[model samples]
Target: MTDDSAALWVNGSVARLQGMPDDERLLDTLRWRLGLKGTKEGCRTGDCGACTVLVDGKSTLSCLTLTREVEGGSVTTIDGASDDPELKRVSAAFTAAEALQCGYCTPGFVVALAGLLKERGRSAPVEELMDGLQGNLCRCTGYAAIARAVALAREDAP
Candidate 1:
């Protein structure tokens, strides 16, 4: 608990947050200090994908991520992805497909899908798409619609 270890900038914005004790959660800092609410804290223990966000372009659970570790890297949240046309399309497809129920975990799913779709491109196969989204769990509508939406968005792309 030193005065030097208070908070720092994340991505490009200044974040005034304090890391919890060794056992505490980082999700609190994200929600409170950074005002990045896109990463949800479904299961604080890291089982649920609800707290997922991007760390260096990889999807990770913000609940378990320490703010200190994030200072030197890029952390992209669902809110950050909204600017991407592909992500916007993914979001629209998810909405049109009705892939969400309570909407708690949709942010994680969308962020993960953004990474998957961007890296895999529109030519990816169904199996690859399924594998990419394997970690995102949706308790609402069947994942078929979600997957279909992603696939359709891919096909619709030039």
Candidate 2:
């Protein structure tokens, strides 16, 4: 690490970025620099949840987050499901409920759900959990299975 470089904990590992720009977005860093393409870019603005990732165990819109702003924070992307227990549980529930179609929004939904469970606990009410995902929009599958997946994750999480 150099004086001009900063780092963040990504997927349970330290990711040191050299000569990073001040205005670089976390979404771009994760996708282009780190090659973690699982976090899709639905909208460059925060309106879409496709760029969601867990920063310090909280769901954040990476499109609106500056990479340098999250320096030293733990970032859990969907690609790191196996490295995070909550993410693993949520992902399993999503899979079992067959909540994905086209798959572009799956990562955001999973990460958002995992973050909600982490914030609200596994015992959080199903309605609250579902409501927390209001920012996440999916053009396919109609969210019935997604709702089921949320319940399953809440029930299955320990």
Q: Who wins the TM-score comparison?
A: 2
**lDDT string, candidate 2, 17-64, tens digits:** 988888889999999989999999997888869999999999999999
Report lDDT (Cα) of residue 7, candidate 1. Answer: 55
Candidate 1's C-alpha runs over 4 A off are 3-12, 16-24, 156-158
Ten contiguous residues minimizing lDDT sum, candidate 1: 16-25
lDDT of 1 at 99: 77
**Colliding residue pairs in candidate 1:** none
Q: What's the distance in Å from true for residue 152, model 2?
A: 0.7
Candidate 1 per-residue C-alpha lDDT over 1-158 given as tens digits, one digit per residue, 9 for 90 to 100: 52345555454455554444444355766787667787787878777677877777777788887766665566677777556676677788788777777888788888777777778787788688778787777777467777776666676742
Give me the overall lDDT of model 2.
Answer: 0.91
Tell me model 1's lDDT, rounded to 2 decimals.
0.71
